[model samples]
Target: MRAYLATSIGVACTAVLVLPLSLPAGALAASPAAPPSGRDAGVRTGPGAHSAAAAVPGSTESVPLRPLGSTRAPGGIAEQGVAAREVRPFSLVGVVWDDADDELRGTVQVRTRAVGSHVWSDWLEVETHNQEHGADPGTQERDSGTVRGSTAPLWVGDSDGVELRVRAAEEEDETGPVRPLLPRGLRLELVDPGEEPEALPYPPSQNSPETRPGAESGTATGAESGTATGTPVSLGTGVSPASGTMTGELAGPAAMSAEDRASSAANEGLTELGAAEIPALTKAAVAAQQPDVAAKAYAAPRPRIITRKGWGANESLREKRFGYTSTVKAAFVHHSATGNNYTCKQSPSVLRGIYRYHVKSSGWRDIGYNFAVDKCGNIYEGRAGGVAKPVLGAHTLGFNTNTTGIAVLGSYGGTNPPAAATTAVAKLTAWKLGLHGRNPRAKVTLTSGGSGKYGKGARVSLNTISGHRDGFRTDCPGSRLYGKLGTVRTSAARYQGR
Candidate 1:
């Protein structure tokens, strides 16, 4: 479980860096305006940090970390060393180091090239605070475990040679002296994201009780649609078979501006058509009128969950087909770790970036989070398994199994998450957990898989609805979003009829 490459980087290691420069050639920026930051989780966006690599012809030589400039920092930069046969062909790369428990000790960047080509991609910065990147200790490398401190995985299409640099930290903005620590146990990892088949479309839609439009998608809930006479009637129990107690809130959901939720009141007399017949329900599906009949007494309304099929998810990109856990007892919320620079329409592409980063770069089987929510409140299916089942996620370290990870699609550290995003979390958990008959407001004890703050097999009690930080040491789900967990939990419980 340890890929510890004991390379001796002197306390005097130094490197030159140009500030405010665009990423090196072959470098890609998801958002140019955003600054750089890191944590120990999956969905991170590479913002302001520009990356670049060497343009030298491909060789068997390994480029070493050379001294660049010293900002009164302790390190004076030395030749960390070079490579001979250590360079091999691989698609994914990672940098690992020891921090002795302090925050981001240093910065690690890498560049790669095809086996025989001289062209090199721009340098990609590895996340230094990657302590929580691995699965729980004693599990699969791609699943979870301890790797001390590591860098975020970077993907270079095809390469045989590599160059890496771990420069000292720059000066602080307060114009004070910066004494950076020379990280120990620095090494580079070359990962081969196992090959897999391209995604295949699902078999033609069938009438298998699963409807794409109404109930499953969490449309408006209340008394059923009535006949043309306006007689109040019960609709087909707007609930998933697995969910019975989810009597959702009808106010905000009910008050949904004649959009988001399709009102059954207007379609009382309309014929019930299969999801294939109507991909996206028409505006008529939403209703604005008050419930004419007695309101159902359930706690939460089943959210209109968008299945993987609805968002055009490309299943083939993942290395693993589908794996399942026993049950989902806890729901951990997280932020994509990427910046808040994308629009709802661009969510799919944003997903693509994360998917590729997780699989090809991060070296995981699929996306880490089980589900993703956009700022606009659109929920996109994550992982390949059925949402109804407990899909093991690589989101929370030491707690990936038996837990579901729902990541909002933007970094929520400094910026506040939109209200739509928060409400979506409540709607989703209400039904999903309700399927498992979980009381959202209850507390559950789960054994730590290992290597986080908790010891392996340690029974730790956690809220049924919790944040990623609640289970691990990283500031995941961010400060702002984490601050609103109380509201999310309360909303979820209310939806669950708690």
Candidate 2:
């Protein structure tokens, strides 16, 4: 395949809901309450310690919520004055809520203590708008019928006890609710992220896709994720040499087999310069040197994509390998939900922060979104794998198969996402989705990969360019950015010359 210049690139829970849910007698006490039993907190575990099979590392549990407090944050500041009881050795923890119609009008934070250790890690904020947590959208997880909306998970090494607190944001509508915005149906997750079985080589011997099954939180491990009608699971892109920028495999990290490509090039006795060396030609220069190529350029409004290397993504850090899915059937848009406190120049640092958080802190293989855009609307690649490949993502639950995840960096609740950011969404969708013969404005039906909303194998109709909320029950892409979907679809259509 000739490389096109444009770039790219959970949990389980057995119906734990059926278990007896007891919130304890003290739903609201000014002082902290005693930690409840796993069953009392609505988690359905049998009596006695977990069985050896159940102890298989990285298994998950979904404990239902009761409510922490009715008091609002003093003077409206983010704080973690509350904490949950000791959980199992599941390395990851994320918060989940019930309603998509409502917003999580606050900031949530968590800290965990490693098993057998009393040391407490520093508090870290959980991405709040992540309601779409569960299985991949079109796989057996979705087809098997189990997924849900959840907060981005926090990776705390090996730990048994977890702590969580929400600093309810002051309501924009003072008349809304004098009490802080406490999201409903809160659940804490303890995931094992079981080891993945290897798959066949798509190209050279790259590592097999160790995808998690139902990672709807957009924060996940192998086989434990989804793609969205909007954007399900997502990651950051660090190495993308194919687009004439960055180092590593030309096919992007996911499909890159560096040694093989290098050997083939060496055999031909040609030294390949990086994309930076051979600059993308100017329109006039393109015509002067290669009239045929320039003529083609004028044939359509080409989407100018930024390369991962262009954004200072460090490729050396990613493992030398690639993972791929079959094809991209949909595009899910999301917001990093990491708050807006960055400049365009600081974008690289922001991406790095997210990358480390996902990999080192969250215990994910890599950052989640396939592509990420900045407030300035610059697009960066996410996850491993080629940006062009279906490379499954852990963005949306029960809907990762045959889909792509594109995330805009920053939260967009009350404040609107920059026009530049949403515009990038349109441009990215136009070029990528166009490759698959998808109409950005058209409606498509995706088989439920799995979720709390539907049965296994349920077919779902969704806009080709959808919101994160459309997948599970997330407020991702945020309310303000989500509202701009109509604009995104319209703009994408125009880019595709719809």
Candidate 3:
């Protein structure tokens, strides 16, 4: 009889051979000095005699039988027997980070061992999914000593649990030459493993559950849960045992007010202000305007009302602009300060001013941007549509060489631009993206010429519009207006239908 053992650590695996004891026939023979009981000789035997006979073979049998303890049967000696082997246990290690649900998510490492072998095969499968009902399973191969997985872009609830499984080919199988053993390990780790949990913003109406915590029985609407009463509710922020309307010390940016959340979403292009909310937001922008703020709006020279001077009103200008032929691979956004405290009606003059600045100050022959938007959200022609002919402008450094640029009025860096402004940016961005056959939400970056500052290139998306600071080194737009670039970008993306 023999036994085997295996062990593993990190990438190294090893196995050891365990020797078993050999029992002789003579050792199992009954002792001659012991008196034979009646039962021992097929007669009425006492308990002592029966015990001795059980431990030793009788004279009638030439070979004595011995009990095997935690040992495998001898090879080539077939008989009904059992064998026990000790194999090394496998281990998994990894780190988790905050996911969309305010839950913790991360990667994991996996390894296994076999009896009597030092080499481990990379033949393992890994999968992960939320423990909640109706969750999809994500699968991956164990590559380069690690397995990675991620959750969906929404909260998976308080009991967000993950399961992992492992399988290997078995040693023997009569049906085939080999069989596979199914051994699995389930790790129920908290997504947010930090000692102090952070708060997560409520999911959007599209992805949020419909029912509020205290609502009576009702049907769930897609990701959102609906209550008997007509209101919908979001899962409480962060992962915890308590379930109800979220209230307590807020943590992280998730604690922001509804206005702040709306601002953030608008900047990110994740959501647009509702139509009803747009008017109020516009009024707020008008009221929020500070008189002391630099009023450089009327600094630029106004365009002549003759023949073809203003945007769409000029027929000769349209004839001069080129048609859209070259692929518009990227886009750049800017702000115009030509008309101080101007309304949407002044959009034409604003476009003319931008066109002049690009030609006169930047040495560009035409307006740099493809489009321009006013404070009231009116979209005007700049390069592509202002004239019939294409007019390339020098806008983004290295990037604008073949990119399209769009300019909006007023400085967004200081305060949140009006809803109208954001809406116009979104519509214009979406239209341009559709015309150019590009994704509005896709990220754009300047690959050459500009300094590595701002992460080596100006990385932006079509959905989230930007001011001049996002790419070029100079502050073409004032600092107050430039500060809100991210918010504007987000808001624009949301409007782009992302």
TM-scores of the candidates are 0.55, 0.50, 0.32
Query: What's the true lDDT of residue 257 in model 3?
Result: 44
Root mean square deviation (Cα) for candidate 3? 32.0
Which segments of model 2 are wrong by more than 4 Å?
1-302, 312-320
Q: What is the C-alpha RMSD of each candidate to the true structure, in Å?
A: 14.8, 16.7, 32.0
**Model 2 global lDDT (CA atoms, 0 to 1):** 0.48
- After aligning candidate 3 to the native by TM-score, how far in Å is the CA of 16 from where it should be? 92
lDDT of every predicted structure (CA atoms): 0.50, 0.48, 0.29
Compared with the true structure, what per-residue lDDT tens digits does model 1 show for residues 288-374? 221222122232343444444344433333432345566678899987654454556555555655555555344455677788888
Between candidates 2 and 3, which one is better according to TM-score? 2
The alpha-carbon deviation from the true structure for residue 424 of candidate 1, after best TM-score superposition, in angstroms, is 0.7
Q: Give candidate 1 misplaced runs (Cα > 4 Å).
A: 1-104, 107-127, 141-299, 309-313
In terms of lDDT, model 3 sits at: 0.29
Those runs of model 3 whose alpha carbons end farther than 4 Å from true positions after fitting are: 1-325, 356-363, 384-391, 412-416, 449-465, 476-496
Best by TM-score: 1
Model 3 earns a TM-score of 0.32
